[model samples]
Target chain A: MEFILQNLNAQTGSFLAILGAAFGFFLAAMGSSKGVGLAGEAAAGVVSEDPGKFVPCMVLQAMPSTQAIYGFIITIMILGKINANLSLEHGFILLFAALPIGFVGFLSAIYQGRVAAAGINMVAKRPEEMVKGIILASMVEVFAIFALLISILLINNVG
Target chain B: MSKKNETNFLYAVAKIKAIENRLLDKSKIERMLDAYTPEDALKVITEADYGYSVSEVSDAHIYEVLLEEEMQKTIKLLSDISPQKEIFDIFMQKNDYHNVKVLLKAEFLGIEKDENLVETGAIELRKMKMSVKERSFIDFPPILRQAINDSLDTFGRTNDPQSIDLILDQACYKQMLESAKSLNNDFVTGLVKALIDTVNIKMFMRLRALKKNWDFAQRVLLKGGSIDTDVYINNLESPVDSVIELLRYTSYGNVCESGIEDFKNTGSVAALEKLCDNYIMGYVKKAKYLSMGMAPLIAYYVAKETEIKNVRIVMTGKINKLPNEQIKERLRDLYV
Candidate 1:
């Protein structure tokens, strides 16, 4: 009975760590997909009218993709710590570590997408204002970066 | 596929924003007005998107043809690009109603006035003509068909052509209001109401100038305006000063003050018409700030119409060899 309980704990601990990585990756990736999709729609509208504006629109549409990268970095760091002997306590800590990035990255990407889309429309009307739009879109990335920092710090303390 | 963004007009609005730069403005019109010859004035418009190839330009006298083609092109562009096309019905239906009026009048009077029919209505001119000729109302909107029947019955009894204008004009507003309400959009609804008020004001002043009876004016007045119908009715017998006083506090105060003064002084609705156009332009200028939805498209349409009207005014003055100041005085405000 003792050996079986120990085996179950080992399996659950590994499962929990992998689940945290999955949450961090998929949630943020889904947000990026949403963000890119929204900005892409507005970008296509601009490009259709004036193909010369394709470069600026392309830059604006790419702004939301960084959140996914942040989530991915945390996800990889969590996975690097995985092993057969990982305790349930460490599993819970890893899971908690993933939560901030998962939630923040997901929301920030979607909201950033909305801003980028609006910016793309602005750039269409006044092509010279493309820099202003890019700067506005990057503001949403700050919170996402902070979440990534805390997530990495938590993963480092898992030992 | 994922549900599309809530801003369904994103594509159309963005394209229109780019296209709007090509619209004629004050300086463009000034160039046309200041040009030495009629053809030179024509040259000014040719540079804009009047939907005419340079080879198609035959003569300045036929600038009307160019204007007509541009109107058709504008209608096609809006209908083709807009996702919420039904919202435009409120505007395009005016042409449909105009076509019906022309066909009905021609049938009644046995006159050949084909030039009165335009090709730019929401419904095709041919369709409206056939429906009017055959007495079929199936293809028409509910209020419009009923207006036709009512106008026909009233004409049969009274043998008056003016009744047709009254019934059709009122029905036009009713149909416009219906379409506006169905959209549930505040901007469009407010625009339609403003239009009704302006039309009512114009009709009241004209009927007053003609010395028409109060009862006739009341009957002809449209139902859906911000101002009450009785305001016109009660003031029908009063002098123009009291009417001006009554409307002084309304949003149309400037229009009434200037339009009524011009009407009283010159006995021409020309100034009044110009002021009303500018007032509507003022109303639509609000759409310039909006980056989404159908506001910009509608604003562009109004802007183009005003541009076309000014072009016609300039061309007429140029051909007649009138002074530039006179042409400038007659010109409506520019949208850009």
Candidate 2:
């Protein structure tokens, strides 16, 4: 792929880096949206019956958005790494760097959303257990944090 | 295939979980049972948000009115929230078939029995009655249409009301199985099969008591249950104890044991009916752990149905001045 990109244009290094940023931003955001959609649907169901539960339900529903934030941070890092003299190898490195958060954030957020939705159901049944449900849903965020850490290290190593 | 359908009921399932809190518990059942008057017993259910508002119904004696109102409300709410509206057709279809039977019997006897008809069904009651009366079923489901025709033809030959019941009951299960298969859901199909099995088991026991012949038993036992005809057909002449022993290892072993033991002692089928209902309730209790699926919705429906039935039992027992133990024996398990 690098060879093909190089042959197509002698100077495609920064373009690849920009592509990496797009991947990190878009894939993670898409995942976060889907996660939020699922959790939001469940939250609405709970809140419909008991309006007082809106706060707890909202907390659980918003848990998946951290994946999008991770994606955003990686996108910014990739954009910062771009320069006129950036080599094609370095461009490839940045593109590969974006992948850890892009793919992982995408999948993790969706799965985390499902967990949060279940948590919302738990809160609906026993309001006192809202904290327990939030803690359970937070377990899924550990993987997203690992993906974010890997993406940060890879971006730092891009030089 | 069913995995995909499981995700569709998320909203309804979660909402049902919330609504489940209002369902009667053991304490509530006890309160209803111990109420001083039948009107006070009626108060227990009315306070739980059952049926139409209390203001609309002036008399407590019309408990059937409140029960019917609750059923209609539950069906409407579930259908409105469900992604697939016809998901509820399996339960509602039974009412339609029942209405059909009542209408057909009335026609055969040259009498009108509107009071015996249940108000809730997938099809409008009036339309179903008119269609049955006119022998026009173009808009009706094909299985039901054919079943009605077969029942008419069979009745013509036998000149017996029993044949009409046998034909309709068989068709009810056949159509339930068909609809469950159409949904491509094992949970639903299994539920329908379990229902058929209970009915088959109860009918077989009743037939054995009556010393019914092989042909009659075959006609009475409906198809589509996991248990085959041979199980009942083979044991037609066996003594009641041995029949229960033979069925000792099946899934229904406990049910048959408890139900038959009760039958042996009381010489009445009422306890068997309660045991069969308990068996179904036990089957549906699996849905409690499921957070997102059609199982919870189905469970909720069964739970509400059981709740209504238990309340009816308590109301009747209290009204008749029966003892508490009798009422407790008749009560089904609580869903909560």
Best by DockQ: 2
Q: A79 in model 1: Cα distance from truth in Å?
A: 2.7
**CAPRI accuracy category, model 1:** medium
RMSD of 2: 2.2
For all candidates listed, what's the TM-score of chain B alone?
Answer: 0.95, 0.97
Q: What is the TM-score of each predicted model, taking all chains together?
A: 0.90, 0.96
Off by over 4 Å in 2: A1-10, B2-4
Best of the candidates, TM-score: 2
Q: Interface Cα RMSD for all candidates?
A: 1.7, 0.8
Clashing pairs in 1: none
Candidate 1 lDDT (Cα, 0 to 1): 0.87
Deviation of model 2 at B184, angstroms = 0.9
Report the error of model 1 at residue A127, Å.
Answer: 1.8
Q: Give per-residue CA lDDT, model 2, range B31-89, as digits (tens).
A: 98788889888888888888876667656789888898999999988988889887678
Candidate 2 per-residue C-alpha lDDT over A1-159 given as tens digits, one digit per residue, 9 for 90 to 100: 976765644358888899999999899999999899888988888888888999999999999999999999999999999987788788888899999999999999989988998888898889999999888888989999999999999889876
